[model samples]
Target: MSYEKRPDGRNFDELRPIEAKVGVIKNAVGSASFKIGKTWALAAVYGPRELHPKFLQDPAKGRLRCNYNMMPFSGTGDRIRPGGNRRAKEISMVTEKSLMPVLDLKNYPNTVVDVFIELPQTDAGSRCAGICAASMALADAGFVMKDLVSAVAVGRVDDKIVVDLDYQEEAYEDGPVADIPIAMLPRTKEVTLLQMDGEISKEQMAEALELAKKSVDEIYEFQKKALKEKYTGEQNE
Candidate 1:
């Protein structure tokens, strides 16, 4: 028996509801939290300060490091062990690449800009959510950026392409499948990060790209609202 799809009958181009909150952690230099459906991510940015070790320093530019980790209870069944793993490392590396283009690294010189993303829920498209949260945190940190980066994921399941896969959809797929995660600078329409997993035909890839672009636009609006609220509170003081 086949399971019924979700309500709203959203088309391939539609995105799940998104919510963003800024300054969630007062102690961090900057912090932001966001959720897309059941998937949630929180990001914190720290420092344009001195590098940790002599060997790690870069004379030409500041270093930007990212750490992406999933909470033990993020998934439904088994829990993940805390610390670096292959998947976590890959996500962190991708996140670092995504933000490097937007940041004004030269301005910071030998300093380091560190970003940490924590996923407290497991669902499809969490990587994209991580990127979105990290970008917002960086913005809250008052770092100069060319434009805000927004991200989204698109995938195919049950012969129907979809935007923002949920946890179950990602797990039990059959036949050819595709998952594309993208990070783009919304204002400039520049792509800083792109990753695809599984196999997809060229036509399907094109369709997914279109859907991701639309999703990113929606996410950008949500992020802007959260940032405005954070700044407004500061102004009122």
Candidate 2:
């Protein structure tokens, strides 16, 4: 998950170009397509619907479950296996955790919200992209939230801290490298997700956290713009 600590010619704080669109799926309550550099994820929201599975249902609040998938052909050179695997499920769980704190679940009693994010293409940091896309999708579904969540990843490259690690930068494996992904509720400035892979000193972790928080503001702006473009465009309004 960590990249080699090399300069790699990328600006330390630069993020990969992101493209986002909402209402991409007409059938879903809400849908979004998101891309960061070469990685792409499509997210759709369905529900506040009746809960079918009895065990997963809650009486006082709407329950939520997430599904994440990476297509077999998402990778280059070789094909990956299709269908839900352990990795996919795990990502779904972490993603659900990150989004859980912000939702006003109790508002929709005896209902369930289903969010699905599919990665048709990926290089790295697809999970982070998923978090961003999922939040927008939920908003599109008209879910109540305290604040929209924004997410990005930070890492140590070439012994220096970097923000938004790209595929090449992330794939680097010369020595010990650390990957730290972060997500926050931007309005409250509260972090909901913080994941670290590999080892780094406390000082390094602090620095990475600082960078992640600052970069989240940029991602948040993109999220707002995407929503506005969908709901506030000339023809949309």
Candidate 3:
């Protein structure tokens, strides 16, 4: 298959090497560790427990909240400060939203399911990775859901559409690189999360969506495989 040339010497349609595993944390209900090239993200799921402050609890459905963070040494740059900043807060919100639609919250009732995501390594598609890892962790946690959400980043570079851009590739252009992150429920083909940093023509947007869908398909497979590996082992014992 013909592919667009990329600065990282990868085909435009190709994703960086990805490896993921679930249940890395023994005590946590669910946990996952994932890496895309050098960038990595870890996620852990806790509770479906009582909601703090009580008033925030919804009696009819459970709550899903995400806390996304970047470790100071995650980036190649100098030691970064730890704690929430504007960027971290925004990403946490989006990441939470991306995974919300797929959860069958009503059954949970008055409890909150907290998903904590950390980017131990910074890269262009960290948010997408966070979503993917969180989903895996949730599945490992044994929640009822329509489907595990799959995510990927789509970018326009040198007039070519690319999947899974790295840090340098994401910073390639000044204008809208069309840095878009999308999350989808593969079975229903429903979009759970979408964010665009730059604008593109209608045609490019269509191409981007198509590209994202295909990329998500691959991601979903990995997620499923990771979950199966975890539960299958437990069943054997």
Clashes of 1: 0
* Model 3 steric clash pairs: none
Candidate 3: stretches off by over 4 Å: 1-4, 174-176, 233-237
Query: Please, what is the whole-model Cα lDDT of each candidate in the order they appear?
Result: 0.84, 0.85, 0.86
Comparing 1 and 2 by TM-score, which wins?
2
Per-residue alpha-carbon lDDT of candidate 1 for residues 1-237, written as tens digits (9 for 90 to 100): 333463446565678788899888788899999899888999999898899887898989899999999999997778988889999999999999998899888877788988989999967788889999999999999998888899988877656678887666667445555677889988776888888877777787787777777778888999999999876775233
**Model 2 Cα lDDT, one tens digit per residue, 57-104:** 788899888999988899865888888889888889999999999988
TM-score of each: 0.92, 0.92, 0.93
Q: Which model, 1 or 3, shows the larger TM-score?
A: 3
The CA lDDT at 83 in model 1 is: 86
lDDT at 232, model 2: 70
**Candidate 1: stretches off by over 4 Å:** 1-10, 234-237
Clashes of each: 0, 4, 0
Sorted by lDDT (best first), the order is 3, 2, 1
